[model samples]
Target: MSAAYVEHRPISSSKDTLTDHHVVIVNGASVGGEFSTQLAAKNYACKEGYHPVHVARERHLQNRDIPDHWRKDPC
Candidate 1:
């Protein structure tokens, strides 16, 4: 007689499904740097099987003092 293996799956709700996604903040002294960092993080998350969402707050751009050199795009 051969034994059959069965895989078990969990029943999850909408809120549980939301847990599969993650939120990350993309912020830096410059726009390019912030964008690059966010992309890197997203790529890493995807590789690990998690959905990454880039999130930013208006306060991050408000009253923020970034130096002239850092404000320039590295590209």
Candidate 2:
């Protein structure tokens, strides 16, 4: 697969915790993974009041600083 890119933007900030804010990813379709997995993570994070970010498969693979488990739950 080619390189993928992911972007994270926080729509709002919370006085309590980072997860208390709202976030969204504009280019979710280009992410190259199972839409369900991405959606599931997105829904799950939002439900928990956490920020949700999206990246292309390429970017995700290139990001060595991000932990493996974080890919599963990015909040």
Candidate 3:
């Protein structure tokens, strides 16, 4: 059965604030999937054929910059 997983985390940071919050959604074998927002990721996770949707939040020190293209809406 197909499964959906969502991970929410921060991708970039400054001395004062955390930025570039990201939500990633994976359906089955695809690990590189990303969503613009948490709601969008949740919606995709709840779609038909995706079983046992899992949602998680992670906190970590920002490690890398987000690409400019990743900031655009995918829809």
Assess the local accuracy of residue 17 in candidate 1 as a C-alpha lDDT between 0 and 100. Answer: 36
lDDT tens per residue, model 1, 1-75: 111111111214333332222222233212112223433534443444433222222111222233321222111
**Each prediction's Cα RMSD?**
19.4, 11.0, 10.2
Q: Which ten contiguous residues of candidate 3 have the minimum total lDDT?
A: 66-75
Q: Which candidate leads the pack in TM-score?
A: 3
TM-score of each: 0.25, 0.27, 0.44
lDDT of 2 by residue, 1-75 (tens): 222223332222343323322223333342322333445546644454544443323221233256552353354
Global lDDT of each candidate: 0.26, 0.36, 0.47
* lDDT computed for candidate 3: 0.47
Winning candidate number (lDDT): 3
Worst lDDT run of 10 residues, candidate 1, spans 1-10
- Indicate the worst ten consecutive residues by lDDT in candidate 2: 1-10
What TM-score quantifies how close candidate 2 is to the native fold?
0.27
Rank by lDDT (best first): 3, 2, 1
